[model samples]
Target: MKAKLGISPIAWWNDDLPELSDDVSLEECLRQSRSAGFTGIEKGRRFPDDPTVMSSILKMVNVALCGGWFSGTLVNEDIATNKHRIQPMIDLFKAVNAPCIVYGEVGHSIQSDRSRPLATKPVLSDADMKAYARRMTEFGEWCAGQGMPLSYHHHMAAVVQFEHELDTFMKCSGEGIPLLFDAGHLAFAGGDVLRVIDNHHKRINHVHVKDIRGPVIKALDWRTQSFLDAVALGAFTVPGDGSLDFGAIVQKLAGYGYEGWFVVEAEQDPRKNPPLRMAEMGYAELMRVTTKAGYVVEAPTFPWR
Candidate 1:
C-alpha cells in the first residue's frame, strides 16, 4: 500500500485556543513542518483563502496541502444552506488537489465551549439521527459532485461523539459521505480503536493518527470538565509518545487495504510541547509503523494540483 505522511497546523497555532498557540507566521509553520520531514500540512487559521497564495507559500517549504477541517452543520441547517457555505472550500480544495475536506459537525457542539461540560454535549435520538444522516448523505453527494469529497469527522462533544453514535450514523448514512477515522478522539470517547476501524474500514477515506495521554484523560471529570479542558490538561500527543500502539493500528488498516494520508493531528499546547519537535516525533513514529505495515511512503509533489 502507498501512503502520504502529513500533520495538522493545530499544534503550531490553534484557532479555538489562541493561548495554546505558538506565535508563528504561516510561512514559518510550513517551514517547520517541512523541516520535521512532513511532506504535507493541513490548513490552519493563518492560511490565506486564495489558492494561488496558499500554493506559493507551500511550495517555498517543499510541502503540499493535504487536507483541512470544514465545520459542517447538517444537523440544524438544510442542504441548500450547506451547499452554499461549502462551495468556497470546495473550490479551494479542488484548486490545490487536497485529499479530502475534514467535515466536522459543529452544530450544537460544545467542543470549543470551555464553559460547557463534556457530559452536556448534544445528543440525537434514533429518529433524529436517521433524518440527520440522510441530510448529511445528500450534502456529501453534492460535495463529491463538486469534485471535493468530504470525510465526516466525528469529533468530541459533537452530536455524533460516541462509538454507538458513530455506528448509528454510519448505518443510517450512505457511502456518499466517507469517514475520517481519528484515533485520539475515539479513544477519548471511550471507544475501542481497533474495533471502530474493523466496523467502518470500508467507508474510511482519511485518517487522523492522533494519540491520547491516558493519565490526563483519566483525570478529567466528564461531568465538570469540557473537551477543551481535557486538552488544556494535555490529553493528546503524537504517536509512540502516548497510549495507542500505532504499529498494530497501521497493520490493521493495511490489512483492510486502506491507502491514503495518515495525518498527525495532535492539538497540544505549543509552550509545553514545541510544534516542530512534536511534528518530528510524529513523522518518525508514522514512518516506523507504516513501514512495518508494508506501506511505501510517497514523497511530496510540487504544484499541488
Candidate 2:
C-alpha cells in the first residue's frame, strides 16, 4: 500500500484555541509544510473558506488540500440539521478534490471545555449509544452520497473515546461510517493502537499519525485539567520525539493495505514547539518508517502536488 505524508495546520494554528498561533500566516503554514517534505495539508480555522482562494494559496507551496476536523452534533440534533451544518465543508472538500472529511462527534464533549476537567467527559447510556450510532450511520451515508467519506474521529473527551466505546459505536453504526484511526488520541485515552487496528482495520479509511510524550501524559491530571490544559503542558509532540512506536504501527497499517494520507496531527503550542521544525521532524521520521514498511512517500495525481 502506497502512502503520502500530510501535516496538519493545527501545529501552526490550533482550532480549539485561536490564540495559540495567532501570529502565524497562512502563507507560512503552506510554505513550511512543503519545506518539511509534506505533499498535503490538513487545514484548520486559519484556512480560507473560498475554495478557489484556498486552492491558489496552497498551490503556491505544492501542498494538496487534505481534510480537517469536523465537529458533528448527530447525537443531539436531527440528521437534516446536521447535514446542513456540514454541507459548506462538504462543498469545500468537493472543490478542493479532497479524499475524505474527518468527523468528530463533539456535541456533548468537554474536549474544548477549559473550565471543566477532561475526566468529566460526557458519557452515553446504552440506549443513547444506539441512537447516536444510528444517527451517525445515516448521516455518514448521506455524506458518502456527496462523494466525501466521513471517518468518525474518536477524541479524548468525546462520547466514543475508549476502545470498548468505539467497538460498540462501530458495531452498531452502518458501514458507511468509517473509522479515522488517530494514534495520539488512542494512546492518550490509554487504548491500544494495535488492538484497534486488529479489530477495525477493515473499516479504517483515514489515519492521524501523531505521537505523544508519555511522561507528560502520565503526569496529566485529566481529573483537574482540560484537553487544552494538557496541550498547554506539552502533552503532545512530533512522531520521533515521543514514545510511540510508529515504525511498528506503519508496518501494521501496511499489512492491512491502508492506502491514504498519513496525517501528522498533534495539537501543540507553537510557541514551545515551533511548527516548521516539528513538521520536518515528523516528516523525516514518517518517511523512515514508511520506507521500512515497503511504502514509498510519493505525490498522487491530485489537484496540486
| Every model's TM-score | 0.98, 0.97
Model 2: lDDT of residue 6: 94
Q: Candidate 1 — number of clashing residue pairs?
A: 0
Segments of candidate 2 deviating more than 4 angstroms: none
Candidates in order have lDDT scores of 0.92, 0.88
Q: What's model 2's TM-score?
A: 0.97
Q: Give the alpha carbon lDDT tens digit for every residue of 1-305 in model 1.
A: 89999999999988788899999988889889989988998898889889889878877877888999988888998888878888988898888878889999999999999999999999999999999999999999989998999999988999999999999999999999999999999999999989999999999999999999999999899999999999888999999889999999999999999999999999889989999999999999999999999999997556644
Report, for all candidates in order, the number of backbone clashes. Answer: 0, 0
- Candidate 2 lDDT over residue span 32-73, tens digit each: 888999989886887898998988987787778877888888
Give the TM-score (vs. native) of candidate 1. 0.98
